[model samples]
Target: MILLQANQVARHFGGETLFQHINLEIKDKSRIALIGRNGAGKSTLLKMLAGEEEPDEGTITRTKNLSFGYLAQHTGLTSQKTVWEEVVSVFESVHAIESQMRELEKLISLESEKGNHADSNNYLEQYAALQQTFLDSNGYGIESEIKSVLHGFRFFESFYDQPVNTLSGGQKTRLALAKLLLEKPDLLILDEPTNHLDIDTLNWLEDYLQGYRGAILIVSHDRYFLDKIVTEVYELSRHQIYHYTGNYSRYLELKAAQQEQEWKAYDKQQAEIAKLEDFIARNLVRASTTKRAQSRRKKLEKMTRLDKPAGDEKSAKFLFQAERQSGRDVLAIEQAAIGYDDTVLSEPVTLHLRKQEAVALIGPNGIGKSTLLKSVTGQIPFLKGAAKLGQNVDIGYYDQEQANLTSRNTVLEELWQEHPTFPEKDIRTVLGAFLFSGEDVKKTIPLLSGGEKARVALAKLSMQKDNLLLLDEPTNHLDLDSKEVLEEALIDYDGTLLFVSHDRYFINRIATSVLELSENGSKLYHGDYDYYLEKKKEEQEVAEMTASKTEAEIPAASSAKRDFQQDKEHQRQKRSLEREIAALEEQLTNIDTHIAELQKQMEQPENLEDHEALTELNNQLTAQMEEQDAVMAEWEEKSLLYEDTY
Candidate 1:
């Protein structure tokens, strides 16, 4: 059954048509992903569907008694109400029925006490009817269900009584989602619902949507979230809606295939037309073949030519130029303790970054990922040690808050300001490439939506030629398509990348290394997010296995025997550590010999004049020294640990 049908829906802002001749039909229990570029009228279409806005042309018809609950990107929650009270408000009608039932019960009891049997009987009957209505509405389990949904979204017990306004934006979004789930409308329309949610909350939402009895239409940039939830995809482009029968990943594959097929058909048709034209041209000049020429001409005139497949071929292509390469030590931090003011949140730590590597810094909110980014960029002071940048390192920073853009400037002005050397036409072209075109470029930065502002920030970043790119939540307000474009651009970017993003799919695609920040401090994983997840899972399984192992399985006669073996192992570790130290010393001796040889060659009267050779030798020596120091430091730490254990 079709729940809603949009016929020839057209929307226009001023003289510009956002979308026209758009036709779409949503069926019962359908899960659709409403996808388009930033300004592609997806939100407008949603509003039209929900009857919040009317289309300039066409009609949106809904089945009778079908209800829709729309969770806008920005939730509107009152400040005075507690979280629990806010969620319970969704069931106010049921509560009202219960209150009526209670009043009827009281009236019946009072009438019976006053010896009014007839009135008492009537009140008792009304009370029974209200009781049935309450039961039918599932009023009994409403509170438990609300609590369960809230818990699924990671709402703590302490937050239940907290005022709604006290929660963060993400918390409020979650609260709104909880209320929507409780309401159990016939259709749910969510715009960037997962924008402010954590991984755990997103996962819970995926589960919730999967089991939802109604249809859902969600617009989100989280590809993983979309893949896990959406059953169908509706792509809005060129004033038309294209429906795909599967999730985001499937949509991508099928769309590529469809484009390929269209291209093939186009090529074949063009070839056929060329052949006909050639035959007609060759036969036209032959005197005896005038009739044949006329017949071919007539066939050509009657031929229906195929229309070429048109799209923005250059929209997906992104390129950046970099100057001289940075030094081998792209970045380094020694004994860096970073925090606000005098409070140190983490211990002194050391880190090193090299060229052509992508690193992702991940942690829970408020655990200092952004602070760490600030420290690395030298925007904030490191309380303990220093953060060192190598020579010729040009940093392209994309801040999470999009602080780079001026509020007063329009999108076009912002782009032009960043690349002042570019002509007006060139700036417009680039802005259009990032999905900002026409009047969209005229919208002031402050007036643009969060997603639009994010796109503008990214477009500005793309214009710079830098050897190092530092991004914070680069995919925050982008759609899945835009995220893919950004991913492709970053993959092709010939630079060192270090970013902090909560988007798992983005991290898995772009990150070559993972740096996890936890209560125990940061730990480095030399793999992408998925690999890190696998490694963590493996460790968890091993720990569980170890915990489940029987003590009897150990070859120990008693606890004393186990203790004695542990002591022996500690002594063994100390001896092994000493051996390892000796080996590192020998390795360092070999490195010193190589450096001395290179130094002596460079010091030669004839070789001293060769700048290239000298530079190469110096770089090699620096790398060797850094490596040796690192190995020696590790050996010293291990030795201390061994001694402590003994």
Candidate 2:
């Protein structure tokens, strides 16, 4: 059944059409992801669906008495109310019925025997109906369930009694989510719900949403979150909607295949058109075939030509020109204790960031990740120990706060001021790459959004390349599509990257090493995010097994004990080897898949016709295949180790 439908929805602002002729149907239990570039009317469309905003030209139809919840980027819960009270308010109707039922029960119990006979039936009927309604609504357990949902979202015991207004923005968002969960709407629309969440909360949300009974429409920049929760993607672009029936990963694959097919069809059609044109040009003057030529010309004129497949021509390309390579020690910190004034968060630590290495700093909120970053950057002095930057290291910083942008300057003015020698067109192109097109370029920095401001900051950084790039949450406020563009640019970049991000997909793609910050300080791991996760999981399994073995020990026969010890060692070694093999095989499979995709791109006639791109694709494929072979060798070695242990 269709839960909501928008027919010919047209929304306009200040005589400018945000979207027109927009038709959409959201069905019962449909998990849709509303995706678009920033400011492409995704939020507006969602509002229209939610009936909070009326369309200028069409009708939105929803099921009668249907409950739908919209969690905006910002929620409007009053600050005076406690978190528990705010959540409990969702069951106001059920609570009211319960109160009425309790009052009737009290009156019936206290009635006289003579009056009780006549009043008993009436009171019993009302009591029975209310009790049934309450049970059906799960009224008895509503409070417990609300508490559970709030706790799952990391709302601590101390936070439950705190006034909503006193909470930070992130805490308020969490409280709003808890309230929405308790409401149990038939349809849930969330906008960037994961922005304020820590990794643990994000994981908890994933588990919660996985089993959610209602339909969900989420707009998030977190690729991993979207992949985990959404079953379908609705991309709002160019004033139209494109549907992809799968998770983000599958959507990427299908989108690539579709683009490839479109390109092929386009090439075929162009070839036929060329052949027709050539015939007309060669035979138009011939007296014997003049009529045939005229007919051919008419057919050519009437033919509907295929438009070329659109590409992200304006996507930022990082053509970094580093001044010079840094020394072997890019950065070193010893006995480092980092944090703000009167709050030394991290314990004493020692770490090293080597030259030409990309490192990602990851941790939960309030874990001193950003503090450590600031200390390394020399923006904040470490409470203890020393931080040293290598000789002649030029650093470019991209902070989420976009502190470099001047509110009074226009985009052009900012770029021109930064790079006086750069040409106007080049500056405009760069700005366009960051989605500041036409009059948007003329807009003042003060008027720009958080995302746009961040892009501007990135654009400024791209103008002057450096050997070291220290980015703090560079992917924050960016859409998934924009994130992909950034990923590509970063992949092609030559500078060393030291950045902080919660985006696992971005970290997995770009980081050559991981720096995990915890209460114990920072620990460096020599692998990407996925590798780190695998290692952690293996460690946990080993710990669990050791605990179990210790609990089940038999302290009797020495020979039996020795044999048991030997068996346990052998089993541990076997499991370790098996895990190693599994990890290697997973890497090999991924490399093979990437190589196959590159090969497909290389085989495209359009790409092949472009000699430069074809050559690049061929080189990439060869490199990926070599990597795959290395991984396979490692896989075989681990397999052999497992066999020997067994």
Candidate 3:
């Protein structure tokens, strides 16, 4: 069923049409992505769909009583309640039903005491109906569900009781998202949902959204996230929206093909039109050929004209170049700790980056990825140990916050002031290459958006001819198109790179090696993000295997005498897994016995008469059932492993 539809929608701002005649459908459980360059009206279109903004022309039709939720790019939760309280508020209906259920229980008891059997039966009926509603709404599992979502967004128990008003902007945004997920709206609209998420949380969200019951209409610049979750893509460009049936990568392919076919058809039609016009002009004066010319002109006039294909929108253009090569070792950090004011974020870290190596530094937010970059650039003093630059290494840094930019200077003046010796025209040309032209060049730095500032920073960095570039979240404000442009430039850059970014797609594209920073220390993975994940998973499996062996109560005699130590290790692991499986099955059996007892209690007439006792027992039963399921799952997994090992 089509949950929502926009018919011939159009939006205008400042007498300029942002988009017109836009039509799309949000069908039941639809997974659609809206993509475009910055300023292409994606957010405006999203707002229209979300009913937060009205279209200048045409109509938006949503199903009657359809629940809608919108999460804007910077939406934050501001409340006096604690984080848990704020999130649980989304389930106000469930809470209301629960309260009514309790009230009904009291009335039912009062009527029973008064021997008003009819009144008691009516109250019991109402209470029973309300109880079913509560169950359907997941009232019993509300706390567990909230905790699952909070955990996915990297919120721990310690943060749950924190006042929502006291949280940081990012945390507030995350909390808003968590609440939205709990609400389970029929139509969920997310604008740049990946904005404040780290890689781990991004992965969790992708998994969560894939199984979301409601339709999702999202506008995001994160290609990887879009690819993972969305099955259909809508490219909003040149005052229109074009639908493409695929993920972002597949959309690129189809879009390219469609553009090529469109251009070809247009070119062929133009050629035929030109030929007919030329024939008409040459033959109209002649007696014998005049009839033919007139016929051709009539045919040409009747033919439908095709508009030119939309592609090749203005995009940022720049490149990274090195004036000189650095030594074999581009940069080295030995036993270094990075932090400020007597604080250390990481243990003594050691890393050696070679010439022309692009290394990505990744970790959770606030674990000091940015601090390490600043320490490397000498913008901040290292807390401990030595950070050394190889011979003849000239460094260029792109601050994620764009802090180094002079706020009062115009875009042109910013670049011009950096290289005063360069001609004004040349500076303007460079600015134009970065998509700053005409009036845009005159915009003061402070007035420019984050993306514009990033471009100005990039333009400046492109000119520096440095042997090493230390970037902090270089892709932060860049749109998908601009990010691709930057990725291509970096791919071709001969200089060494040591940058910190939360964009997994960008890291996968640009990084030759992965440096994982943690509280323990820095560990190097000798591959891209995918390879890093593969290695990480393998290590986890090994760790689990070792843990099972250590936790097992297996006797030494269970391992067969082996000629090789590896054989002994294998036999030992097999025996240990067998023991674990047996233990899980035994636990499952006990849980089943407990569940049976609870069921017996629930079926008792006397127990059912006591609402409070019944409710408490029901909650416990639900928890026990959930625990049993976990145990059963563990048993199945362990059984499979045992079979494979034996």
- Among the numbered candidates, top TM-score falls to 3
* Candidate 2: tens digits of C-alpha lDDT, residues 1-646: 8898888888888878888888777887888888888878988998888878999998999998889999988664666888877888889999999999999888777664557766877888888999999999998998788878988877777877888999887788888887887888999989888887877688889999889988898988888889999889988777777789999898889889988998999999899889888988888899988888889889989988889987643455445556554543567888788788857787766777755678998877888877777777778888888878875578888877887788899988988898889898989988877777789899999988888887888888888778888889999988777788788888777667889888988999999889888777877777898898887898899778666664335343334656767888888888888888778766765765676588679779899799999889988977885676567567656755775674
TM-scores of all candidate predictions against the true structure: 0.78, 0.80, 0.83
For residues 1-646, could you state the per-residue lDDT of candidate 1 as single tens digits?
Answer: 9999999999987999889988888888999898987778888889999899999999999999999999887775656899988888889999999999888888988999999999999988888888889999998988788888989877878888999999887788778888888999999999888876666567678888899999998887788888889889988887778889999999999999998898899999889788878888898888998778788788878988878987553353445556545544578877677778877766555667766679998866666777888888889888778878875688988898999789999888998876788999999888888777788889998898777888888888878878988898988877666678888889888788889888989999998889877545677777898899898899899789767767875444345466767778878877887888678767755765675676678678766788888888889878876785686577556645665664
Model 3 regions more than 4 Å off: 107-119, 274-294, 550-646
For model 1, the run of ten residues with the poorest summed lDDT: 312-321
**Candidate 3 on 1-646: residue-level lDDT in tens?**
8999999999887889989999999899999999988888888888888888999999999998999899998899989999888888888889999999999989999999999999999999999899999999889998899999999999899998999999999999998988898889998999988988888899999999999999999988888899898999988888888999989999999999998999999999999999999999999999999999999999999999999876699878878999865544568898888888988888778898866789999988888899998888777888888788876689999898898899889998898887999998899888888999889899999899888899999999998999899999999889998999999999999889999988888999999899999888799887799999999999999778666774343444245533578878889999899889778867866776677688779879998999998998999898986786677567767856776775
**Which residue pairs overlap in candidate 1's backbone?**
none
- Candidate with top lDDT is 3
Error of 1 at 435 (Å): 7.0
> Which structure is stronger by lDDT: 2 or 3?
3
In model 2, the worst 10-residue window by lDDT is 550-559
Clashing residue pairs in candidate 3 (N, C-alpha, C atoms within 3 angstroms): none
Ranking by TM-score: 3, 2, 1
